[model samples]
Target: MSASLYLVAMIVIPAIGAAAVAALPRERGLLAKQVTLGVSLVVLLLAVLATAAFDVDGDRFQLTTSVSWIPDFGAEFALGVDGIALVMLLLIGVLVPLVVTASWHEADAGPRPTRVFFAWLLLLEAMMVGVFVATDVLLFYVFFEAMLVPMYFLIGSFGGPRRQYAAVKFFLYSLVGGLIMLAAVIGLYVVSTSQLGEGTFAFDALRQLDIDPEVQKLLFLGFFVAFAIKAPLVPFHTWLPDSGAEAPIGGAVLLVGVLDKVGTFGFLRYCLPLFPDASRFFAPFVLVLAVVGILYAALLAMGQTDMKRLVSYTSISHFGFIALGIFAFTTEAGTGAVLYMVNHGLATGLLFIVVGMLIGRGGSRQIGDYGGVAAKAPLLAGAFLVAGLASLALPGTNSFVSEFLVLIGSFPERPVFTIVATVGIILAALYILLMYQRTMHGPPRGVLLQQDPAEPLSGTGTGTGTGTGTGGATAASATATATRPAAPGTLRVLDLSRRELAVVAPLIALIIGLGVYPQPLLDLIEPAVSATISDLGGTDR
Candidate 1:
């Protein structure tokens, strides 16, 4: 197979699938879901093939294929991948299948049209791949903005009770950022015209232009504001928590897992390369916001009562590290940021799946509603614990490696920021353990702890001298409820269902696998990272 074939297939296959899914008869509910799953898997295969075809050690972008789209404006239907882009493609590829699997029965959840949900997901995947692969700045912006349509509907139509609000908030924030970015794209085109005698949005062309320092800062702000909103640095991060909490598990997975990465990807791909002086000039201010985000978001996460919201806050905290790594201007820090994006997807994606399971059983996302779940479902508890540990960057987990690299690589260049960000590590432990202890360790509220408890508990579980909880069943004792009958009116909870296990098993393996052996990914990422740093005119500190 030709190299362009893999890159082209990654986008085309999903576009074709979206069309096919949209054409499916509404009556064929199962067929719609199955077809979407199959297409996602095929795209994933293409991603793997693309990885195989990618020249990881190559100094320039590989598999580049461009065709004129607008000769008058100097735009084209161009595509290619650097090692960084390849990693992102692979991340999206892996996440899409799992998202399809996680949402296998999601059509049954809300009142929206099931076929539309599947179609939108496929559409989102195509655009995401396009964003990562596009070589022209205009094309990137187009995909960047266009991808929002599917996600907006995905949340508004298939999300929770507050879905519409979250969707609109997400849309408005993104639109504002996008409009700002449009101005920058226009600015770059003008610069290209001044330098090359005709306007162009080609990334390579823009990189070659000699831009004025003042103008570079202006253009960089336009781009930085958009990416910051998307990277969602601190003050600009409100939409994320709202969207993550309200969207379906599948949407949340891509929203937090993949879509958000576009912001950071834009930084590495566009900001640094196109405006090196502006990047260095702005690094200190960006570093300050990143450090603040790491602490502020972690504190907020600790105080959250809702499970999804807590995880969302943690991601914000994690993004702080990603941003810190990028601006730290070290190859190690940048590579760690890239790896962190991939590993964050695995750890947090798994966390969302685990949270979905809990919500499905508990019927509430409130942390106060659940307790002592480990006694009822060890498999589920164990999986949740693994995800939690990964999120906290526990030793021997994938997150540990990335987090360690970010801090260590950043210290020499930005010692103060690195030290402040390190405090998030302790905060991570506090929040992850707190959520686990409350949800998995305490006496469960709704289900029987075991086959039977020593004594059948009465209403509210007050027999153990505790107040009432949400579900019909309640238990306050650690060991007293193992043999008691389920409280009247509450359903007995079972362990992780087969389908649920299928969704999370691969992620668990990856969390452990990458933690111990991250060299493979690092090797691919380091060259690309070195190239990005070189573009920024920086040396590894």
Candidate 2:
């Protein structure tokens, strides 16, 4: 397909699916779920096709097609993907289907659940793809803000008891950031108009304007604040843990895996290129915050009792590394940073899935709530461990390669910052291993052993089981028949179900595949990194 056709399909297909799902009768739960899942699969296939057709050595913006989206305002419905956007779109395509699958039961939960929930999920996917592909800054911002709606409802309506609180916090923080960015967007337009005798929100047109350095810094901050909040770099990061902890598994997956990347992505796509002088002026401040985030968030991850919150904190720490890689301004570090975005989504999304499984089976997010799960649910424990190791960037996992490249690359340009960020790695190992041991090791909890637990918990849907932690063994092995009265009230909890397996299996493969042989991904990333750093006049120190 042509680039315009390809880009249009990527955005429109899911939107059509969402509307279709929404129009279905409220009682058609299973059908609604199926339709949404099918749409996501189709999107995934489209992504594969796009990848196959991509020109490895081509213009920065390939498959680009533009038409005026807003002629009066000079904005266009222009869409394209460079190497950076291409990978992000692929990541979005991969995650949405798994998200629909993983949260199938969540979609089925409550009265009238599937129709609205699935629709929102698909809509979220549509907006996410739009953000990555839009070449018009105004168009990018519009999609950027629209992304919050579905997420807000997902968290508020479907999340934990405190879902409303989490949803509101997330919305308000993002709204404030968006408003700040709106000012910057206007400033850029004003600059474009003054120079060219007409206003335009087209990215290319705006880039040609020569705004005063002071004005550039002001506009840059407007955009940077928005991206940083989305990145959740430290003080700005508090909203993330609450949102991640409260949202349904699918929502949490997208929240961290895709939406948040917009922050760092903004840095790469907009900030660096649009305002070079401003970027240089702010580099040290951003660098300091990135380092602070690494240590501060890791320490908090060490202390979190809620499993999802811990994962969120760890992401904050990881974002720190991503920010460091961008600012370090070496080709290797920048490439590693972009690669880290993809790897973090896979590894951390895996962590969330495994943790969701544990919460489904064990009934609580607390670390001390369970033990001896390794013996009962080896597959579950193993999956959790692999994800944890990946979070810590263990060798032989996808994240390790990216993290190594970032650190090694940064050392030449920023030795001290690199040294401090390295400490985050050690801290990462501590938090992840400790979380694993506490949740997966020791004896199975009483809660884990149910007499006849009705059905497996799906997503955050309410389910009942008395007592806490499901660590205790059933005493009898599966091979032998029940010789005696099977202990008072204990039935074996199953290991990774087919649905859960379906979610993690693909991710597990990618985690290992990319970690072992990352050259293919790096090839796509290096050229873009070089171009960005070249703009900054930066090279290996």
The TM-scores, one per candidate, come to 0.92, 0.93
> In model 2, which range of ten residues has the least summed lDDT?
466-475
Tens-place lDDT digits, model 2, residues 1-541: 6645788898899999889998999778789989998999988988778877777787778788888677998989999887888899889988999988888765454333568989989999999999999999999999999999989988887776568899999999999999999999998998888899999988777766777889989999999999999997877898999899878888999999999999999999899878888998898899999999999999999998778889999999999999999998888999999999999999999999888777766555677656777887789888998899999999999999999989988998789999999999999999999989987776555344432343434445222222111112211221122122234334255588787789999999999999999887787778777877876667843
Candidate 1 at 60: error in angstroms?
A: 1.9
Q: Count the backbone clashes (under 3 Å) in each candidate.
A: 7, 10
lDDT of 2 at 300: 94
Clashing residue pairs for model 2: 69-76, 371-443, 372-441, 372-442, 444-471, 444-472, 445-470, 445-471, 445-472, 448-470
Off by over 4 Å in 1: 446-491
Give me the candidate number with maximum lDDT. 1
Q: What lDDT score belongs to each candidate, Candidate 1 first?
A: 0.84, 0.83
Instruction: State each model's C-alpha RMSD to the native.
Output: 6.1, 5.0
Which residue pairs does candidate 1 place in steric collision?
Answer: 371-444, 372-442, 452-482, 452-483, 452-484, 453-483, 453-484
